[model samples]
Target: MRKNPERRASLLDAAIEVLAREGMRGLTFRAVDTEAGVPGGTASNYFANRDALLTQIGHRFYERLEPNAALIAQAQEGPRDRAKVVALMHELVERVSSFRSGYLALIELRLEATRRPELRRLLTERIRADVDANIDFHLASGLPGDRTTVVQLVLSLNWLILERLTLPDVFPEEQVHDLVTDLVERALP
Candidate 1:
């Protein structure tokens, strides 16, 4: 039978919150129950096991990126101008900076995915699709090439930005903005 969407969604939301606060070990059923304000068995009823619950968390992690995908695709199709492409990348970079929890969840997923092939495959596919989408967008925008390397470059830049945020020093947002802007001209242009 289909699980109640509200309950399922609530549990997923709670899982992310718990994951950020406590890492994967923090996702005890009791913690999720309290976080969701649901009955003790509510999450278990849907997931039936810990792996199921964790997989759902990974799915939620990817879902948060979906809206931005369309915006990027639109930017790709709408303009060949370098300024527009760079602007879209700026918005994307800014969004990533603001949405720290999702990034943390992704870091956790990477650590956990080694033992969970399903998650590894799911994340792999999601990344491939994102890269494909971005490439298509760039192609439509009149980028004659840059098929394989853009994904690697974009993700590398993302990791660099995240790492910078973890530094003891001030975030240096302007530096990152300038850096990403330069990357846009070099990579997406």
Candidate 2:
């Protein structure tokens, strides 16, 4: 397989767009090549197979969604209180929702995972690690929450993002902010 990091990243990004726009059923090497604006067989050179592409996409989703260094620094500056946690939750929602296509593709991949056991295992492991990291971070940061609080916020906020993406009318922007505040306030000590 080709080992060009930049090319591989581009192909994976194109795959994400294809998955979001076309869903799992429409995702293919040809579709990714077209999305990436590369010539035929380009994506095939980078990925071994559909499962490999899907697994890479699962990893890439988290890579794209991770907070930047500046945001982490800013978060660390503030007092670790319930209000800070609320701000963090708000930031989290905004950050994840900002990458609209990535999150949408993740949803599609999740549904597809139900049929593919390998994909199911990959997503489960990655998501579990992410959840664990969040719990550990919350505990170490002295954030006004326990493991349950972090879990609740993660679960609730993910659905909130889904709602915001799939059904924008259900909760307007301002209402979502208010809801985040309410969720954090109620979840924390």
Q: TM-scores of all models?
A: 0.83, 0.97
Q: Which regions in candidate 2 have their CA more than 4 angstroms from the true location? A: none
| Model 2 C-alpha lDDT per residue in residues 1-189, reported as the tens digit of each score | 999988999999999999999998899999999999999999888888999999999999999888788987877886889889999999999999999999999999899999999999999999999999999988988888799999999999999999999999999887999999999988875
| Model 1, residue pairs in steric clash | none
lDDT of 1 by residue, 1-189 (tens): 237887788888888878777888887878888888988877777887887778778787767666555775776575467677567667777676666776777778878888889878877887778778777766656754466546745776777657755661544665777876777677644
Candidate 1 overall Cα lDDT vs. reference?
0.73
lDDT measured at residue 46 in model 1 versus the true structure, 0 to 100 = 81
Alpha-carbon error at 133 in model 1, in Å? Answer: 2.3
lDDT of all predictions: 0.73, 0.93
